[model samples]
Target: MSMQITLRRARPSDAEAFERMMNRPEVHAGLMQLPYTTADFWRARLAEPGGPAVAELHLVAEVGGEMAGSAGEDPVGPAVRRRHAMMLGISVAPEWQRRGVGSALMAALCEYADRWLGVLRLELTVYVDNAPAIALYRKYGFEHEGTHRAYALRDGVYVDAHAMARLHPNPPRPSPG
Candidate 1:
């Protein structure tokens, strides 16, 4: 493994860099449901209205000691019954793709999901044509639930997404030592 890259909670300082990655054209093409968002909108989103949830975490991967990637989760719905579930979002800088960053973030999200919130399921949607991200989701044990046809319009045309979820096994406890 690449030990030089460190993964941790996204601090306020890392917000701008993370937003930059989110705004990248390839990232927008592969990951988003719409066009690039304004910096202010992204900043507010990263600020987290209340704060980080143990389960609803925002993480960044620092490589060579610089912010290189990010991942996050948020309540999937406003309804009380759906609070136990969260949505997943992950991104690694173009230069950092296929490195350990995405895996590290997924591991952290799973840990937080099971142990912190006692969540039963965690899910995400990836563009139907995004093969690499789909592979990554599968590696993390997310099963494809189904695909939504033309769920999003990209470049004035429709695109689809595959919804996937992982129902975790029992969460591991931290070592007492």
Candidate 2:
């Protein structure tokens, strides 16, 4: 049976669940990270401040009331000129793959970036072999910027990654002083 998925901003209380989901072999492998994520790290990330001035958004996807996936978007740099672009990261549980959880998380993040935060560019990097994630980003208008060889080390082997980005079609107006 199919499960319903919902997207919401992540909370500090979700640290433990986030830690568990991210450490899974399949999910962590896709993200090119060692299985060393800690709950305290997630808690600190979730508790950080974010709003119009700084559009850091950490989002979670829930399936049947359980955390199924997570995504985050934050400025690529802190300089004034670089605030228009944001970097993205996402991960979905093994059981949640092929479902709508990833899609929902992407949609929410893009919406927040384009409509709410007025961000002009959204960027992310995915392992070259992660076809499902690459396809999902393409569906959201992200294009391949280029490839980085030996960009990440996974299980003692270097892997290539594709840089992808989406430009907002109609950005929101900046807040006036």
Best by TM-score: 2
In model 2, residue pairs whose N, Cα or C atoms come closer than 3 Å (at least 3 residues apart or on different chains), thus clashing, are: none
Looking at model 2, residue 6 earns an lDDT score of 84
What TM-score, to 2 decimals, does candidate 1 have? 0.86
Candidate 1 lDDT over 66-165, as tens digits, reads: 7777888878977888876789998887788887788888888888888777777899999888888889889889999999999888878889889999
Task: Estimate, for each residue in 17-101, the C-alpha lDDT of model 2 and write its tens digit.
Answer: 9889988889899995669789999799788877657768888898888999999998998798987899999999988888888
What lDDT does candidate 1 reach at residue 165?
A: 96
Clashes of each: 0, 0
